[model samples]
Target: MPLDAESDAIGTLLLERGALSAEQLVAAEDLAEGWNVSLVQVLLARRWITLQDLYEQIAIYHDLPLVDLEADPADDTLVRRYDPAVMNRFSTLPLHESDGTITVATSRPGPRTLLHIRDLYGPRSRIVVATHLQISAALQKAFRDRHSHDAVFALAEQDPDMSAQQVVTPPQILVLYVLLSVLLAGVAFAPVPTLIALNIFLTVFYTGNFLFKGLLVWIGGAAQETSSRAIAAGAALLREEDLPVYTVLVPMFREPEVLPILAQALRNLNYPLAKLDIKIVLEEGDHDTIEAAERLDLEGVFEIVRVPPSHPQTKPKACNFALRYAQGDFLVIYDAEDKPEPDQLRKVVAAFQQSSPDTACIQCRLNYYNARENWLTRMFTLDYSLWFDLMLPGLERMGVPIPLGGTSNHFRIDVLRDLNAWDPFNVTEDADLGIRLTQKGYRVGVIDSTTYEEANVSIPNWIRQRSRWIKGYMQTFLVHSRRPVHLWRSVGAAGVFGFVFFIGGTILSGLLNPVFWAIFGLWMIFGAAAIEPFFPLPVLYLSLVNLLAGNGLLIYLTMVAPFRRRWTDLAPWGVTVVGYWVLMTVAAYKALWQLISNPFYWEKTQHGLSKHTASELAEAKAGGPEALAAAPMPETGP
Candidate 1:
């Protein structure tokens, strides 16, 4: 009954029961010591034996009864009294209480857990064994409604100013009404003057937008190189025992086919598997993905969190629900089709260590693996290279609030929870959270790591995805700009200006491009004489400069974006970016319409459409999980 003897006996029992090979047990014991974890954890992480078999042996070793929760469910009222999060952390549930004594069920029924159960329930408590998954299911079933409500409205209740629950506030509507009235009055009284004034304002804005973006690229490019090298070096020196427990939330809905891809990618990470708290957050109604995930037989580090159905079914909502049960110092979000570089998490941890104490979030770069699939994929890759690889770092350097990309952003779990997690009503919850963090005096940093994803190869799919993004930007702008003075005081003057030129510019350019294109087309068809009255010589010259210079800068920036990765082949494709802009214009209009009609609808982008998907899956299956984990990290640069 001694501690060391019990530990040794557990291994002996597994070997005697034929649960694991002697060779495997020896390796697992060695790893448990090096990892500073339990031998059971090492064996579970390595998937050397089934959870049922492992628990059966443990029950035999401890001389305790192993009860199947599915056959005899826990008392709902008893389980409901305790916090689900606490229950999950301890993996214990109150099964029965009588005569001042409590009967507790747990998948992990060791001395420490027994002590915890006694502390939570009473001095005289009986222990019964159940799988961790069984206890988790009981807790979820007991607290589904409460957790669901909190996930959807926690930000709205806790921090109304940051939530998008109110799509357009009263003050915002008033400002729009006043601006429209003024424009109508001017046009009625002095058409030509009003027209000239409008032209001047838009031309100046166009010039400022162009200059600001060019500046961002210049600063961001330099920052990426320097910061990346430092983070990579620091990560290389990190020891396994020194690494903290990390929680990864992969929220997917009905994407069954790509589940294996994400599972393999997570396994391929360089971090210790035993230290990972992985949750595959799925909607309760998504039976296909749920069944598919179950069939995969993922390691003990992985768990499936079924989110109860709710209105405004978005990724943020699911993640918010999952956040409650997350048991880690740090947390990150990845999509179903993502394949992050193996050392990305290590680089993020290093970045956080090197950052200021106030740094609450770290964003990584995103690119597409199938960049050469087609013209659209190539353009999409360039866009991401500029935004994540270049623009985001520039924002970090200049103290501007960043709008986070959809995936691969890591956060401090405490800060994230203190901020009420993500707003379920905002389609672009990640971006909105970034700004909110800055307003609350927390810094957001960007690193050089990349998570390659499946780019939208089909034009319609691309439109659906882009429109939702644009609409989310619209919502973010509206929510933040409701009280301009409050925003300015909170984020400061420079942050306010950056917000305007970055977030505001994205929304306006999309809505305004077609009108300007029409004007240019008219002039091309019928000489300047046809449009002379609309443009005075001074205004006309400025308009010409805005058109030519702005477009040229965009094309040039796109061309140079891919050069950081030595993707010289993509440089030529950047010249065709004008067509890409036109598609954006279309998406922008669709986004505008949706903002008016259906604001919170998340347009799901169909994944696994790339020609490369089949080949990637084949390669993953052929190489096996062990092979993928042992493979060398991908080189990030020339």
Candidate 2:
């Protein structure tokens, strides 16, 4: 057969053997061209043919020996002839060496790879056909030691300066403590002036923060209108064979109650089953979840990766370890209780195809499934709706850096690896990664897809979750601010402004909220004349406007959140969002204490605590795409 016919021979054989229908072959061919992947890969990804079927066809076509790495392992001495990186790059393994000829097993033994092999082992080299999985397994075993180390945490371990958990530098802490001491001394000796100065500074700060937040909300609303129009135009469709492999990493702690439900939700995704790579990352110490997962007897595509116990056991660290074993071209992260839309993966695939290459990540919206469970859940749902639906889209529209939501973030595997994956020490690894990507000249976009999660209904659980988030935000702010000039150069002036206001302002607002609330309360209740002198006309006006309009705008934003979801029944509760902020203040103080005392400690948030989990899971399983289609837009009430 001609060289061109040789490449097409496998497809022809598959068709002849009745393994693939004529229509499937034609569709796969078209997809192979579009995706720039081989016909076998397309067929395997679509599950049109089994690995054994493809291997048999390839062996017949190539006239080479077939090897199964699992049954007949490669000789370690032969494998050691080439570096692991080179082996991975070529997708080939050295099987054996004898009589000055080295035998190599490869899935794609094309002329180019053959010639490369000949160049490495001279003209006497022999080639063999092997399944991709076999070659991958062989290579993995050969490089087991090298692959054991987590690339995600390697940078931080090598350079302590890069660790995000070290929120404040020693020098910074010293200066801050010294300044606080001086301020307290001044308060003791010169109370009036100190109080007046503090009030003036805080008033201006609050006013600026209020205006900045208001601007984001306004821009977000406008962006939502434009996005709706774009969505109305319809999205691009992806053929079954053109859909690439997608790896999903779900890090779980001791919450085994939701494992079965989580498995069902993932299986419900509207994608090719053969192309899904879902890894359930569990801590080594959490044998209960591991046992639960084992009991489920998950499908071949679903795997449970037990992470070895280490210092500062964190979700990101678990993700980092699992990432090393991922084989997909694209990947995403999901939380334990998350029930993403069935078409979310398809949406992300289409979004990536439509976006520029520089768009490294796409963040999907997150809302609570148990929004109506209780008052806390309602508020939690509103907060998510506002942040994901409005603020993130606006930031994407304006080309500003977005702090990624913890879940539903789709990423290109190559880009993610190039950026060193996630910061294991950053509690909000997703958020830190978003900034790091931007800093490296990559952009993050917002998608229309949504994932439903169980909101923490109990106040204590909510506080634990919220405080970790606040602490993470604090860490993100401090890490990025370490080199202001470099950050500005990377993201430009507008990006810098957005980061400071969005990230820095968020942390500062949480920390300073109680102080301002106290002053307002004292002014209202005491009618203190001494306080009047401290608040001059301008300061007094700004403070009053911030207290009234700023808060009113916040409440209005909360109300708007429910409108997107068409949950009008919850809109009336937006007024009660102020009480929610009070709760946030409590969490913020707790976060502050943790930040100072135990910055690296991860306070685990208990999931599966919502009363509506059973109902939501049932709805999710029954509803599928139809339910998601009828679902209202997400609304965050923060």
Candidate 3:
């Protein structure tokens, strides 16, 4: 092959330059053909040669001069003239202009890139070779401000109605004022009637909420049984070469200790390592974790994405920033302590294949690895088991918009980007995105793959975490409920009902639980006459049903939640779920207050608190990904 020919052979060039062994060249050739990618891509993916060496040989082959982008950076003045997206996509940056001719630096230097450069920067444009990382770094340095601003305000600017930027819009505030004014007027004029009416409404709401939850569990349990089998079988038969490039985003802040565990888990994934575009998204200020990631010396597939310091430094904002550079057909978010099933990506791909074209996201189940660590962990596990393993699937079956868990949500990058990605203002951006996807004529699918996380064992930490979740739910409800007619039309009557009970009920129940408990306490201690004025005969009957049957149903649901997982020991602990509700009530009040005070604040959940953390880390480091996957559950006994 001629050095200057259009059909320059990269492998042959690498071999001639003594960059690759003969055996390695043959293997890379096979993978390159099977993966339907270029020989350069295969060589880079396999890490057969250092990037500099491979690019140098390519520079030699293409007869192009190689430039060090870092030593002599691109001119911001010239680079800003072209679209950053196009530049990033082509890995081409305008270096400088000389005599009306522009010099460009590109990681990909070829006829196609040559044409693109000439078309964009004019026919006088010239090309030079550089590494992919160098071009990416230059782009980031040049466009950080623009990308950061877009990440934070894209949804708010483009679709105000879908954003939680304004916690309560004018119409919503007016509705609240009208409702409060009506309640106050009724109380002043007709105290007895007002109290009775309020009692009836709340009693009915409680009854409906529990009943709705029961229906979901029943439906979800059935769906889980059938669908999980089909997904697993599909995943088993999937060929490694057919898998699409997947982007895994692990966003961390001040959590360096858990990086190793996360790294091992990603390596354990069954997907081809070369095709995985894993980005460890870290805040620019979080030098500790950033340094830790760098020291780990992860494989070439893993890249550290340094997010610029910005306000509302929440996970979603970090994720939004990282989403800009994602090079994958599909993207999934994992937390610092998450250990998803190795086949999760394959299962997600298979599920997408089996789903309708409108399916834009796949939500995998989330449970805790430290389920038996403490009372809180046990209850949290049962809660997740019900929410993920049961309720989400039921929501899918019934066509109700599902509330996505914080992690393990796999999205089609195109659809996600087109939707302006995540809302930075929503603390629970995942849940908000799920609802938004449904409203925008897209469907969210549920899969059986599970991502085990470190359950909160401490009470205060659990409350902070739960409070953030509830607050985000509050924000989601407010944002989506702004145009009630539009919501009803978009998601239909069933979706409307589900949203109200699922999101609204979650908020109201936590706030109202304490009041109901106090009311019941007074009725028992001070006699029925003490509460008789508030609870008329019919209203009293309804309140009694809500207090007895509603509570019982919730407890029963919690007990049965773990049965599907064959976590029978957790069933007995479910009886103490009332205690869990008390904690939720505390968190709910905190969430409510914060919604009024600090709606966008994200209460960071501290991981590495589990008693088994040290052991898990050691296992991950020593045994590798497979060992971590095959690790047995901790002893459930007291």
Candidate 4:
């Protein structure tokens, strides 16, 4: 039969077998033609039939035998005839050899693959049917002996700077120490001149940082104003067959309580089941989470990837290991507690299609589900709203490097691998990867979608989470700044400035807030007479202005952040921004200490602690998948 005839025959067979209805088959055919993809791919993507079933039907149609690689291992000598890479690329494996003739198992035994097989194995080579899973497993087994080591773990040995290990260079340490020593000496000896100079520098720095952030907030608001315009004009429903395979990696540790909820949330995604490759990555020794996952007995769409116990033991490391097994054109990471909007994947696909090829990443906005859990949750929500809702979009608009949020970051699989995936040793791999992507000349964009997560409601948990983040930021700054000229050339002036302010300012603000507060308190209580010599008129005025205006502007940004999300009631609680800064200061100090001591320690934040889980779950169930797709896209201000 002709190629087109065979393709049409397969569709006919599937319909005859009751695998697909007439309407679904027509829709699949239309999508296949529109997207320029194969009819088999469209059918598989739509989940009309399982891979096994599809291959089974194909075998019957062609009068071939069905072979299961798992049940029947391939002959070693026959497999050795072909290179593993060739076999993997073509999705074929040699099944057996008899009387100088070879039989091969292939999920896709198309003309091109068959030609290659015949070229290598001679005209006598015959074809057999096998599921994709079997072919993948056979390839893994074939390469297992030669490629047993995980790529992510080996990255540290290959490029120490790129890995999380040895992040802070010796020169950076020396530079920091010398600066601190000089500052202390000046404060002790030449207090008058030192205080005046220091105050002047800080005043300018604070003003720049404040104005930059305020501008972003303004731009973000404007972007939001026009967001609806774009949505209504360009938004269209995505066809199921047209959607590509999307891989979701959910990395979990000891948190077992949220497994059921996480599973349910993922299952509710609107994408076709067959096109969704969801991997729940867990540490090998995390028996609690492992057991919880097993108890859920998630459907075939979900797979459990147990990462071997290794150094760094970070979430990115786990993701990197799992990256090798992902079978998708695009991928996204979700935290265990994350409840992403259902249509987020479709939105990302649209964003990717609309964007340039250099745009390798799309970051979705994140908010807390239990925003009103407590004072800490409220503050966390406010901070998150300001960062994701306003700051990130502003950064994207300016083409500055973005620091990716830990979850809901979608990436092109090929680009992600070419960039060597994530830094296993870096505590903040996501942020580090984001910078690296920009430095490599790839663009990261922000989409209008959102993913809801549980906020760290407990003070202790908040500190642990915040400190780890701060430490990671510090690590990213040090790693990227090692070669200043290269970074400048790579990211350009705007990128360089954005990195300094976004990464450096975030770290310094937390560390410097307490010091300024202490100085202000002492001056207010004991009068300025004792320190009169240190504060000349200009320095005094600048310090007072920064103390009053800089902090107030930040508080105001937080206040307006909630209004974007229609959380008007919580907007009033932004007054607690001062207290939030105090808590951040504590975390900052802890982060500094950890950076000097145990830099790579991942302080796990306990989740599923909120008492509102039941309500959140009920809401999710009530809203269903369509609710998330139908929800308005948040205005990303210009």
lDDT of 1 by residue, 1-638 (tens): 11255557889999988988999988878877777777776776878899898888778878888999889888888888887878988889998888977788987777898889888888898888888778887888888899999999999998897889899988788989999999999999988889888988988888888899999999988876767789999999998778899999999988998877788899888998888999999999999999999988999889999999989999999999999888789999999998888899999999999999999999988998888888999899999988988898889889999999999999999999899999999999999999999989999999888898888899999999999999999999998988789899988888999999999999999999998889999999999997788789988898898889888999999999998899988999999999999999999999999999999999999998987776666665788665545544332222
Which 10 successive residues of model 2 have the least lDDT summed?
A: 629-638
Error of 1 at 361 (Å): 0.6
Q: So what's the TM-score on candidate 1? A: 0.96
Give the alpha carbon lDDT tens digit for every residue of 1-638 in model 3. Answer: 11224223777787888889899988877776666556776666665688788888888888899899879998987888889878877889999999999999888787789889889989987889998878877887888899999999998999999999999988888989999999999999998899889988999999999999999988888886667788888888888778899999999999998887787788778887778888899999889998988887666678888899888888999999989888899999999888787889999999998889999999998998889888999999999998998899989999998999999999999999999999999999999999999999999999888888889999999999999999999999999999889999999999999999999999999999999999999999999999998888888898888888889889999999888778897899989999999999999999999999988888999889887887887886797656867776554311
Best by lDDT: 1
After superposing candidate 4, which stretches have Cα over 4 Å from the reference? 1-89, 93-105, 109-112, 119-130, 134-150, 153-163, 184-192, 224-228, 237-241, 255-260, 285-301, 614-638
On a 0 to 1 TM-score scale, where does candidate 3 land against the true structure? Answer: 0.94
- Local accuracy by lDDT, each model: 0.88, 0.79, 0.88, 0.80
Comparing 2 with 3 on lDDT, the higher-scoring candidate is: 3
List where candidate 2 sits over 4 angstroms from the true fold: 1-152, 157-162, 174-178, 228-234, 255-257, 284-300, 303-306, 615-638
**Would you estimate the TM-scores of all the predictions?**
0.96, 0.81, 0.94, 0.84
Q: Candidate order by TM-score, highest to lowest?
A: 1, 3, 4, 2
Ranking by lDDT: 1, 3, 4, 2
Ten-residue segment with the worst summed lDDT in candidate 3? 1-10
Q: Per-residue CA lDDT of candidate 4, range 158-277, in tens?
A: 556666577667987799899999999999999778877887787678778888899888887766546534542343566665788889999999888676677767766766655778
459 Cα displacement, candidate 3 (Å):
1.2
* Clashes by residue pair, model 2: 382-636, 382-637, 383-636, 383-637, 385-635, 385-636, 386-636
Q: Over 4 Å off in model 3, which ranges?
A: 1-30, 46-49, 619-638
lDDT of 2: 0.79
